[model samples]
Target: MANSLILSYLPRGSVVHKLTGTTKLIVFLLFSVATMVTYDTRVLVVFLVMSLAIFKISRVHYRDVKLILWMAFVFLLLNNLFVYLFKPEYGVEIYQSRTLLVQLIGPYTITAQQLFYHLNMTLKVVVVIPLALVFILCTDPSEFAASLASIGVSYRIGYAVALALRYIPDVQRDYHNINQAQQARGVDISGKDKLMDRLKGSANILLPLILGSLNRIEVISNAMELRGFGKNKRRTWYAKRPFATRDRVVLILGAVIAIGSLIFTFWDGSRYYNPFI
Candidate 1:
């Protein structure tokens, strides 16, 4: 049960884990926006390094998120491949320079500009993934909900987010149990089985999973309603905490990074850092 959970908070008592949820959420938003707003390789590399440092501080092991990281890599590779396939000259258009490295059939020529653009895009993904994983793995759902509420988000919405995060592990556990039970009953869901047979077995699992999820949702809604949840415009959060000095410092640093990134990226009237200049 402990090893199977993904995206649920782990209490490691690390500095990142000890920080108030509000600080983490706000800082994450700032860094994410800053990263997406800039195409400067310098800034992106700095952000990537900082993100990795923070991930290390959060005490999350690579082995814990190995599957997710691999999935992200695969998806990133496919996305770049498709982008190049559809618009092989997009980088040249953006950078206003073209240096052909290799000529390929059907207008699919490789160029330095294309490779550089792809490198920046890949860095964005790599930078953001570590920060996001740290946020998800270090934050408790209850505290995250309170953090959202502190930022003036609706309590109902905050609670919904909390529930979703809290339920991810439960859903995985349920699916595992159901898959095991079905296999015991002769449902061939193993990879050694034919693809069609596996699909059928998976379909059989989906029905029960959906029904079970709906039932759990209904029960939760009824419980909340009976307890007079959402009866007022505001509600007190059980996990709310006051911001400490560290929280304030982090938030200030986040603001500096965000504003500095904007200035660095656009002061020259363009987001791209043109080495061809």
Candidate 2:
């Protein structure tokens, strides 16, 4: 359950957990937009600090989100590499200057401009990813569905989202159980095995897991049908929550940050702040 915290809620009593789910979702949306749309290093640095602070406030341990963050780090690294490979001169064009660092193959020379651009690009993800993980970790799926409904989204869609979030942990638990059962039966899926053999063994585990998931899905669908789900124009949420003062404050802060990002990024008629000049 702890290992599955990335996609499942922790049900903690942290300040982040107490806020309405809608508020967190809105803040995530606004925060993501604010960070992504601006390239001001000062702005991005501040956003990064704020995001880290929020993650700490959420009280989710580093271990709870380490896998997701590490995965993002790998992806971010690859993205930067691919960008440089495809467009080595993109930063030079954007910044309108080039301070050469190393001359590599033909057009693949490393430059100060490119590194600066990539640094800002990486910072955007560094800021947003943790905040997103915090939101998912702290908010209960049922309350999140209710929050979605409160925001004028369809209740059916909200319920579906909640079910998806709930199912991640269920699938994880199922996988662990099945793995243990198979391992006890002498099936070697351990890392000691050759990579190919381990993959082959995994297929055996995957087939049963998939079948179990299908069975669970069928059961859930039948239960929903029996309860006349989707028959009403609007359904009520079991964990419906209203926005309190704290939630309002969070919402307003996100809005202000988003608006401020727009102003800072576009005030000079460009999306970047070039301190290199």
Candidate 3:
């Protein structure tokens, strides 16, 4: 199960792959802030495009990105649904004009404003998702742990972060296998089954998955204890390497971008302040 999600972690030789995990993490947080500060569709679109360009340079495969794209699409669909339902007026107000796009059956009308709102939301995901994926996929887990320690996180905490990142793919694989096993047992999870029955079947799958995960966690904890995970006031890393000049440049660039974004937000008074009125 761990292997399945971890397989998506591409081993690459790009500059991004060589970057210290701590630096990458700081940059990722900054980019996330910049993304969240603006509601302007144009700004978000520009950032999203820039992010995609970085993804291309990082050399992560297209297939891996496809998963993120699918998730983003689902988010966009749900965002539009909610906006068009309860806050249709706010969506209509964003573009500062009422321009009808299409009218669906059952009294639902799509407007330009709603379209732009959904577009902006999608763009936000686009800008953040690639960087998030790149940081995880490119950095080795052990190296990341060491980098985290250098940044003042305890070694134990750093290890936990790596484990958590690895756990995501593990859980996804476990869920798939559990679903298949349930299906093999003549559990009807399809459209043919009643909605309540399907829900119950899914809940049943979760039981074993949760138990399995807890067991795995216990095993890891015991192994760490055996090795004196927290016994030493200092820990040594086999993969530890000093950050290079290039790394410093990257960190500086990230800081500049973050600071510049904040400055622009404050100066224009349009960062967190959405001037829809």
Candidate 4:
């Protein structure tokens, strides 16, 4: 079940994994801002390369992220389809030019500008996904909570965030176990089953999963209350890590990149790079 989970921190000794959670969080934030601040294709390509480089440094296997990558592509495809369906001339409006490449129907013509705009949109997602994966895969949930607390976030809120992240794998494991149990009782959710049958069988597992999750939540709440978990305004984190030289360097670099993107993006007086000009 751990193998099937979307995002659980991997215990790797890579350079990205060695950074403190605070550093990773801050750098990720900066990278995200930089990515969103520009529609410049060249800047996005740089960010996309940087994201891949960071992902490689993290030593997370493709198998670990294959499912998520597929999901992301599927989502990107659907999003692009919907965007074109609803607003066919969106790119023409943005780039202020429409060099028609093909005419599918009345309002569904394809243009170079539209393809270019969508290319930028695709690059944005491609750039951000890897960085997000690196941050989530490399940082421990407890350390992430500590990072939030170190940045002046409430410990209770930080702990809640940690719990949610930790629960993702737990919930997946529960679903797997429940699915297996039901299969033992002659239910078929395997590929051998019809699509509708598999879906119904899966739905059946949700009730028990929800009940089990609620029971676990109650047990955890009781234990926390007994230990006076929120009695004080501050709490110590055993996983808290201090910033090191590498962390400082990464943060400085990230800040520069973020600010540079903003400046470069607005320098031409528009976020969109008008090569059509």
Candidate 5:
């Protein structure tokens, strides 16, 4: 999808990109679930390191994820801030200990336990995002759908996903073209305009973007119908590939990592590894 951070692919020859789409998808799922289930600082740190290493191996640059990273940073900061504001002592309750970090205004006091909790939350995000980005940016939409179908998902669902991913860039390109056309017609969407003016200028682009999107959807629907889509219970994929040894290795590794993370993190009968204990 056009400007999507985790649904658009960039064609590359990197090893990460060479992996089968299903394998990448498996890795993404396994790592994401593992990260979500564990609150162990050590586990999170290991995942963080592994994520960074994977990103490096994928040859992903800061520029590739620049906007996504900024958005995630803003979101995480706001989430942490609100958590502290509303439930600053939640960490203490969970960990069954309290160590004051600072005495803030009113009911808003900071504690090491809460900070650690927030740190783990942040680490969880860091550990999952790169995997998602890599899976999205490295996998081709058609190949992804084919891989999905190969994994026993219905071809109809797989085709729908492929189309959705493929259309994101189109929608984005349409938005940009419409914006530029409106700007040429004397709309002030440029940064030189005041913030409010720029915000309001979006009004000029919304109508055209929506109309363009609807028109594109109609065209795609017609084309799909003409091609006899969804007419059969089974379908063959043009982009499907037989799994390679590397694919098997990746899948096995992902499963092992996920299971290992779960076992180790919950070995003490708690979702969180309480360092204070």
Candidate 6:
């Protein structure tokens, strides 16, 4: 519940953090789509390296990147396990058609094609994950809401987005507190308790958490209504700031990269690069 996991609330002084939330959102979607559409491992590696460089420039800590890398490793292991177990024939086909990259057990083998496929998938995560983490870490909740509202999102929807982001950290903190309270009360959460009993105990914590959150939300809503929140057709933002020239440049550059990647990928006539083909 170290609220740090969900949203880093880190100081937003970097160039990337200065960009409007709406612009970041667009860039994120475009980059994700481009990464998913390509299967060339070399291209994906290049993209991943570029993304890492951006993370460095943005001043995101190495520790955060390391944590993400651990998660990525877990994801990679799971992916390989599933593929090898369910699609052993795929490995054989790839190795036979391409080149044997590695030979495992008596008959099991890893092929250049299989290696590249997994490498590309891993690199996609490398490119997308850091950008996503940076976005959440650097952007302020209030600024994000203002940006969303400026871009034609209704105030209610924008507020909802902000509230959801805010609630992530709150929920984590609440869960940790509840866990500690239960432990203090001598609830055997980690002992040799029956699985059903442990699950029921965990479920019991949710009731208080949900009720507490509801009470807080009601208070906020009442305050907003008293201040004539929705009565005005036009709402003003105290934290709103106009997007700067650099933000414009970043948005344009992001668009260019997205479009260029799409055009090049399609022109190659292979959504998934298969060297065997």
Candidate 6 structure lDDT: 0.74
Model 6, residue 171: distance off in Å is 1.3
Q: lDDT for every model? A: 0.92, 0.88, 0.77, 0.92, 0.86, 0.74
1 versus 6: better lDDT goes to: 1
Put down candidate 1 lDDT per residue, 104-183, tens digits, no spaces. 99899999999999999999899999999999889999999999999999999999999999999889988998999998
User: In model 6, where do residues sit more than 4 Å from their true spots?
Assistant: 1-5, 62-73, 83-110, 150-154, 188-204, 221-236
State TM-scores per candidate. Answer: 0.97, 0.96, 0.75, 0.96, 0.93, 0.77
Error of 4 at 129 (Å): 0.5
Tell me the tens digit of each residue's lDDT in model 2 across 1-277.
5665457788779999989888988888888888888988888999999999998888888888788878998999899999988999788889999999999988898999999999988998899888889888899989889888888999999999999999988888888889889888888888899999899889989999999999999999999999999998987777878769998988888899889878988898988988778
Of 2 and 5, the candidate ahead on TM-score is 2
By TM-score, the best candidate is 1
Report the lDDT tens digits of candidate 4 across residue range 1-277.
5566889989889999899999999899888988987899989988898899999989998989899999999999999999999989899999988899899978899999999989999999999999999999899999999999988999999999999899989998999889899989999988998999999998899999999999999998999999999999999999998789999999899999889888988997988888998
Per-residue lDDT of 114 in model 6: 70
Decreasing lDDT order of the candidates: 1, 4, 2, 5, 3, 6
Model 2 residue 73 CA deviation (Å) reads: 1.3
Model 5: weakest 10-residue lDDT segment is 1-10
Give the per-residue lDDT of model 5 (tens digit) for 1-277: 3334334588768889889888888788889999999999999999999998888888777777788888889989999888888898999999999998799788888888998899998999988888888888888999999878877899889889888999877777788788778888899787798998888889879887888889989998999999999999998877877789988988898899889999999998998988887
Lowest lDDT block of 10, candidate 4: 1-10
For model 2, the local distance difference test gives 0.88
Which regions of candidate 4 deviate over 4 angstroms? none
The local lDDT score (0 to 100) that residue 143 gets in candidate 2 is: 89
Residues 128-151 of candidate 6: C-alpha lDDT, one tens digit per residue: 888887777777887778877877
Which candidate do you rate higher for lDDT, 1 or 5?
1
